[model samples]
Target: MTAYLTVVEAAEHLNTSVRFVRRLVAERRIAFHKVGAHVRIAVVDLDAFVQAGRVEAITDDRVRRDLSGAA
Candidate 1:
């Protein structure tokens, strides 16, 4: 079953302040749902948001290219 979390729950899960989560909602950076007067975020959406922010390590070839002025 999919999990739906409140803003406070999402903040706790992300180990961030509730205000930060609210900011995300305000910025529409993360997907959220409106239930009447409440806001909820899907666990998957939160995970996807985190994944979208991931930064992969640069490869050695890319580093070499940059160093050689090939970029």
Candidate 2:
């Protein structure tokens, strides 16, 4: 069974504030479930949300040089 987390738990997992997690739900930014008037977030959904925001490091020498204002 997939684990479900409450707003507070989700916040703790994400190292953020409960208000931020609530805001995410309110803004429909993160996937959540409503169970009997309670909001729950699946661990998978949370992981997916974090993955969606993943930004790979810039490793290209040219790109790094350009960004560094080096010729």
Candidate 3:
């Protein structure tokens, strides 16, 4: 069975604030369901959203190399 999560749970899982999660939902950037007055996110949807925004962390050396010629 698929699991559903509350806004706070989703934010914790995303390592972001609840406001940002709500903004994503409000902007239609992520999918969610409204149950009465509460918003619920599907685990799969949250995973997909996270994957879509995934970025690799850059080391100091990499940053210097990338910005070598920048003024």
Every candidate's CA RMSD: 2.0, 4.0, 4.4
Worst 10 residues of 1 by lDDT: 62-71
Worst 10 residues of 3 by lDDT: 62-71
Q: Estimated TM-score per prediction?
A: 0.83, 0.83, 0.72
Provide the global lDDT of candidate 3 against the true structure. 0.93
lDDT scores in order: 0.97, 0.97, 0.93
Task: For each of the candidates, give the backbone clash count.
Answer: 0, 0, 0
Candidate 1: TM-score? 0.83
Considering TM-score, which of the candidate structures 2 and 3 is the better prediction for this target? Answer: 2
The residue-by-residue lDDT of candidate 1 on 15-61, one tens digit each, is 99999999999999999999999999999999999999999899999
lDDT of 3 by residue, 1-71 (tens): 98999999999988999999999999999999999999999989999998998999999888898889653
Q: Ten residues in a row with the worst lDDT in model 2?
A: 55-64
Clashing pairs in 1: none
How would you encode candidate 2's per-residue C-alpha lDDT over 1-71 as one tens digit per residue?
Answer: 99999999999999999999999999999999999999999999999999999997877997989999999
State, as a TM-score between 0 and 1, how close model 3 is to the true structure: 0.72
- Candidate no. 2 TM-score: 0.83
Residue ranges of candidate 2 with Cα displaced over 4 Å: 61-71
